[model samples]
Target: MQGFALYPFDPPGDIAALRADLRGWLTVNQPQDDVVARANCWASFDAGFSRALGAAGYVGMTLPARYGGGDRHLLERYVVIEELLAAGAPVGAHWIADRQTGPLILRYGSEAQRERYLPGIAKGELYACIGLSEPGAGSDLAAVRTTARETAEGWRINGQKIWTTGAHFSHIMLALVRTEEESERNAGLSQVLIDLDTPGITIRPIIDMAGHHDFNEVFFDDVLVPHGALVGERGQGWKQVTAELGLERSGPERYLSSHALLAALIDAAGPDPDPAVASLIGELTAEMWTLRQLSMSTAAKLAAGEDPMVEASVVKELGNAFEQDMPRRVQAIVDCAWEGSDDLARLLRALLIASPSFSLRGGTREIIRGIIARGLGLR
Candidate 1:
């Protein structure tokens, strides 16, 4: 189908209602203090907050109603995600499960798998992380060496995954492993679900330069999982994961991580504002708005069951650039010290330190651009 079919990114009438309801619910339930919300937005790991969100019917907005989901359109979910990120709510706890995992299970999982996992996920009680990146294979997923050997009992996985976000706090891991022997890169790959508490598995936290501990290195030394743990067909991991990456890389989260900082910059500038600062903010805002429209279009494609790899890559590349650029550009134009007005300064300092990873996560800029190039038939 042509991209123009999803041309308009404007929210539908129901989507507007969703936005209003979510906004009102968040105002009453989430932290009223701007700094707290600003600091937490999507990155803060708060299980209780996630549970609250799930209970409020905001967690699984798109999954079928049969599996405890809201059975709404993807755009409805998009609105809730936008509000959460804009408020900087502590959504990290259930972000992965709600965003991609639930859909993955709904799409590829068996009846039993869906029955067991989707309900907990919709309830925000089950947390999962992607086990794709490794020490040698971060962006080049085909280079992954993690192997899962099938056994009479189950699959024995032996490999290591690095930079697994929220792995320490997660209950399950959807890991991509090589299941076929001597197969070339991108072939023989399969995705497996493993319980984090299973014996023979170890997790060590990787503290970032910002002193945060969300990243981790997970080791699987003959870790065993039941056959039910496999997500899809045995040797179709590459296909499944690529489709999943379309879900992972394209979203409001890709662009909204530093949104709090952007708002803070405006506050710091006050009325009249510096002409240079206003210009910079206006430029960034315009870029963000364009990216949002592109992102909404991508989401619409997904809603229509199309794997918009090229479009998703474009959004991710441009979104990452904007996210990484916002803090540095703001710092160049404004006072970044933590003194004087504390709110904006604190938000700026937090984001300034966190900005470096904006492009690194959700696939690096280099890898994203490569995907875009290939998508454009330039390769």
Candidate 2:
């Protein structure tokens, strides 16, 4: 196993003031939705709230100012993301665009593509979905079989993408496709920007156990896009997508999915609680603090332009365990009905239902553990 050091998470500027300001802003702007909505809050979509956040200069914090971004430091953006997730803000509508797609485009997209997409993305009105998973692919992105054949007219795409979150509502999709004929595994693949409204494209929702239509199935049949839709270098999609996954796996969202349940538990326990409940709260808090430190260190490494793939996998793996275990632990000790109506009971039920998908979203447990093992020279 390789030894790892925690990078310093010191961000320039008054982080205290920044957090205070954002808290104040959220106080005035955040909607008082159902308590259940606060659990897995990132999946709570609200387009109007997203636009409001963008208008407040919180949407595209790290992108260059020329593209209507805040041009702030990456850690500063990280602080904002932390605050938003902690507050259970309904940021689902523009989450992908702000988190990874916008940055990915800035890094590998064409000038025209940047000019066309970045502005809208910064505004938070435009949305994007990742087109990496297929029926059997899931987290095994290397197994992607989607194809995009270049023709005189344009690039004709014909394949299906499954479990694409927000595809039904997104404006665009950044897809990995087999660009070179006879390509196998990750070779000869390229990223392409596809407008969701393009002809011959179809999107159908797949409701989860929670009855949310966040995931979808996207289909492309002879769908043609311009030659410029290809992002970065051809035959380098594997590298680009790997970098994008680093961004996806290391954020605070990995652990904060069931935070509302924790908050509700604390509230239900009150300031003076039974010894066992107090002990449980202390343990959960300690675990959360540790995860935050790991995630912050990983984010700092990324901000310094280094790939912390191993550290990120570590965060994702541990964070997923923390989140999935939290609700079950709470249910085990708490005296709450299975379908209770109180805030604590409601949040507990909601998180228990949502917990199963936490490990599956960024990457499955087996995949994340495999990445960590490889990083340790064991694979």
Candidate 3:
């Protein structure tokens, strides 16, 4: 792969004050959930907390004020996200809407669509799920088989989307479907914004190994949505979805999702930890710092309106390795019992169960590496 340059993450205005203000808000508003829940905290759903955070002007920080947003800088939003992740705030309820859907709609959806969705999204009262993966497609988005035929009245959608995160609770879904009858691969595919409550749509939960209902299988049979539900140009879904993946992959969430475990490990180790524990802590800290720099650079490139697909893949790949390795490494060296109820042991157990899905979610490791390889002109 070619060398990647780091884009400086310099957000304008008083960043320190922003962090301080957010930290203060979190101190009062953040939930006192189980330490295990804090480990992969982004997936911890709390609707009330989401609404409160939105009311505090932290949910839709980057969108325009007319859309119920703060009209804040992208990097400003980045700082808020970092703080929220670090504090282990329950952001899952509005996470997809605030992070990607809101922006995607602002960029591609019609004015009417924007007016209908953006305000509720910014208020953290509306949620969205991605409708990309199908039964056999998985991360191979080009292989999607969901068909949406254009009808006189509207578009009729018929297909099943598997592994749809938050679909059970989300208000809407930005779905990729075959719009043209004879289209192949990525061709003739289009994005449609579907309301989850529409008729002929069924969302069944897919509980994870950790016993969490974060994933779901959504079925659509003759589901019809208005023509205006289409996002951006028809047959441009691949490009739009690629851009959305960049946002999904390059965030602080890539590394900070497992931060609670690190914090718990440190607390359990105490100041005078065993040499092995201290060494492991140092190693994990270094990896996290490196990931933060890479993720921040990718975010900066994105803020400047540049596509950082390869950079994002690199971040996701490395971040997944770091996260998946953390629990294993801790288990190997730490003397904590697997079934123990202590904070460190509980976090360790939770993360170990959760880490397996880290690489699989954004994109599989092989797929991500292939993207990076293609970026390097090696494909």
Candidate 4:
């Protein structure tokens, strides 16, 4: 809440025990999904697994019990998420909300908002999506032109949002909209809660570079929402959006999406690591570890309620770069007979093909660099 809470980011010595516990739990609970289903990665949504996590009190690991959460430490939550990514869990369904939307609502939403949203969110029954990027303004959030005007009844929203992850299946969207006039583009933005199924709202899937349909092009055509939908004060959206982005960027998931592929590569290496292969793996793994530590440290800052946006941007950029290498190095070395499945070769191939989107989807590397520079007070 004050600054990047990452200062005391290191996990407790009991992390090994936590890891063991998580492993045992997952061993009993990991969905027995078909390899083809698994290849779709986050596409499955895995409502069953999600409900299991909620039942285990693992979904809302860091939120207050008052909201039906587990009330665990922030770092403990980090451990769960990190393990999920490493194990290649299907987490895309509640990813954004679990990571930040729920917290964002708790921090900024009114009492009624909390009462209505928190329990469902905590139970993994409700899902959240973000509505920030637009057709021409993906990374340049300040360039948003979506307008919400107050009406006698509520607000009427009209604009189109692109690259909207989870919009198709999400219950709600934390939409960043223009609420007032601003000489500076970023100044008048505001975050609002928009119901996905509301009239005048349409969501069509957008197949990303990897030929996956996890994202969407969402259009708001005179969509009406109550004034209560606004998340915070009308003029404070920029700050809220930045806070959300910080939470989004600084997580183990950023660098570890392709970790399963990396493990597959290692397992395929029969007896000994080839000298060149070892160097490449070493380079990637070393960088991945560094990025992960940086990310976890940033998460530490966030857990303490700090902006840590600058730190997050640094980690995202670096981790994204490292993540991009999974496909390249795997392709160059491994003679795989498969693409992405139970077969190690197939898994490596899919990861390689999906590598290009690694840097683009979450936040473009360029946007991250600019944020880092701005964080350093550089123009």
Each prediction's Cα lDDT score? Answer: 0.86, 0.93, 0.92, 0.80
Clashes of each: 1, 0, 0, 14
Which structure is stronger by TM-score: 2 or 4?
2
Whichever of 1 and 4 has more TM-score, that candidate is 1
Question: In candidate 1, what are the lDDT values of residues 1-379, reduced to their tens digit?
Answer: 2334454555456776777888889888886655835653666888988999999999887888889998877887888898899888889999999988899999899899999899999998899999999898977879999999888999999999999999999999999999998987999999988889999999999999878998999999999899889888989999998888898888998888888888877887888888999998899999999888889998888777778888888888888888888878877888667554587777777777887787888888898888877766686
Off by over 4 Å in 1: 1-6, 10-13, 32-40, 338-341
What are the per-residue Cα lDDT tens digits for candidate 2 across 103-201? 999999999999999989999899999999999788678889889999998899999999999998899999999999998998999999999999999
Best-performing candidate as measured by lDDT: 2
- Winner of 1 and 3 under TM-score: 3
Q: How well does candidate 2 score on lDDT at residue 272? A: 100
Candidate 4's displacement at residue 157, Å, is 1.2
* Candidate 3 CA-lDDT value: 0.92
For model 3, the superposed segments whose C-alpha errors exceed 4 Å read: none
Q: For candidate 3, lDDT tens digit of each residue in 1-379?
A: 5577889999999999999999999889988877777888889889999999999999888989898989999999999999999988889999999999999999998999889999998898999999999998986779999999999989999999999999988999999999999889989999999999999999999998888899999999999999988999999999999888899998999999999989988988899999999999999999999999999999999999988889999999999999999999999999888899899998888899999999999899999999988988995
TM-score of every model versus the real structure: 0.95, 0.99, 0.99, 0.92
CA lDDT for candidate 4:
0.80
Best-to-worst ranking by lDDT: 2, 3, 1, 4
Deviation in angstroms for 140 in model 4? 2.0
